[model samples]
Target: MIQMDLEQRQSSRFVRPFQVTNHEDETFSAAFEGADVNLTGLGFFIDDPDLFLPQQRLSLRIKNEQTDEVYCLEGVEVIHLRPDDSGKYLCGCHISHVTSNQLLAHHRLVMTDAETALVSMETSKLSEFNFMEDGSELSTDESDFQEASMALNLAVSQSESNQQEVARFVQSVESIFASTQSSDMKLQDLKEEFEDFKQYLGQMNESTIAFATLAKLLAHTPAEPQDKLAWKTLISDFETRFLSEEQQVAYDFMHQGLDADEALEIAQEYLKK
Candidate 1:
């Protein structure tokens, strides 16, 4: 099986070594080096997730890793933040604006020997995982499609229709990409690819959605750090009660007499498909 990086964002992120020397904020002339974990002309993932706020805009000066090329991008929006295992935050931003020349320059600078090779290898794997290919990618044949359907069946054993639904979704994606492969590909192809993935993700089983949401929330939220705060809050009245599956699982776990930390861990795993 091809290894798939759970690309949680819409952009195709290239995760090779790169650096950004930035007065990432507007007010200071002084520059700081943020961890350039992944680079794309579209946006970047900066370190220190807590340092930036959601919906914030930044100005950055990015330096090329393999050469002296440097470029500046402004009005980059801090779209979302995810935490890595090392206790640092991956701050994702959107490149709201850039000139044509700057865009070309950034692309050229990032297409270094190491990054170029890394992108080519990863893109091949990603193409297999998605069941589509252009000349630049690895094609998934009919047998590969059958394997995928079988995998889907095993994954969502709760319902045969779930497997059928997902199989059809994948086939439609294959058709779209195959049709587009005959012509010269454009940025629109990228857009369509993401739309297809988003649609597939939306149609995922409840357990999968719940698991992904939990994965996202745990990576960012602080409420779990303290035993006093539950990831899900409880509000009870004389009349009615409201709680999510996560909340209910957590509540039951607590009632069974486990400590907060242990209960949280078990609840999270239980909700995952």
Candidate 2:
């Protein structure tokens, strides 16, 4: 459970809800506390829960308690819904209209640190309980929890740092590609740079390995002549220069459309030579 202090401005006595009318129609309407307000979800919520009857529309009204202001939000989509033990349906809503001031007010309330900590603790307890049997040891040392938390923090920090490095590398490659004039040379340079970047990524965190692979592939696979040239030039200075003839042959065979097995065979042959 996340606890957040409700902003006074956003605290409403009631809220007016609106439903989608036409399957193709992008907008809908509903009555509010004697006034109607347009609403939109800003693309945040996507799922429509009621499966929204083909062409049928629904509306909801919510009132703000503090200001006694009533907002009629239209074109609301039911992103999520759950039925309680009492058979009351709770729904998560997204507004399709952007002009609703009530929607803006709702976002102002931010979660507090104490609330966040409680939620974290509850989640950890629940996870641990789910893994244990009835008689299993349930208590964990505070030190262990602290250590685990610190490790998670360190991992997140390392991931962010690696992302920043990759971003910098991509920017440099883009710059080079933009400045270069030769197409073939640019392609070669881009490939080399991508290979070097991949190697560097391998030496870093395993969590980011797939990301690095994707970035390298994207950096090298430009369909446009200008893009290819730009990438080639951008990567020229960063291109991984083969340290040995075997590595160079392997790189060449891979570029030549050789299968992985064939590339490996060529590399072995080059090494033997």
Candidate No. with top TM-score: 1
After TM-score superposition, the amount by which residue 16's alpha carbon in candidate 1 deviates from its true location, in angstroms, is: 3.5
Write down the lDDT that model 2 would get. 0.37
List clashing residue pairs in candidate 1: none
* Candidate 1 ranges with C-alpha deviation above 4 Å: 1-11, 21-48, 113-273
User: Which 10 successive residues of model 1 have the least lDDT summed?
Assistant: 231-240
The TM-score that candidate 1 achieves is 0.33
lDDT of each: 0.44, 0.37
Residue-level lDDT tens digits of model 2 in 1-273: 111122211111222322223223323242111111211221111233354332233454444334443444344554445553444444444443322133223221111134432332232211111111222222223433432333343334446666877997899689769975688877887888888888879655543332232223232333445534443432221223211344335435655666434654677777786
Write one digit per residue (lDDT tens) for candidate 1, span 1-273: 112233532234455444554555333244343444322323344455677787787777766556655667664667678776666566666554444334334445544454453553343221121111121121123433332333233233323435666687678667766674645463566568678767756545543333232322222222223311321210111001222455456546655766444555587799995
**Worst 10-residue lDDT window, candidate 2:** 125-134
Error of 2 at 242 (Å): 27
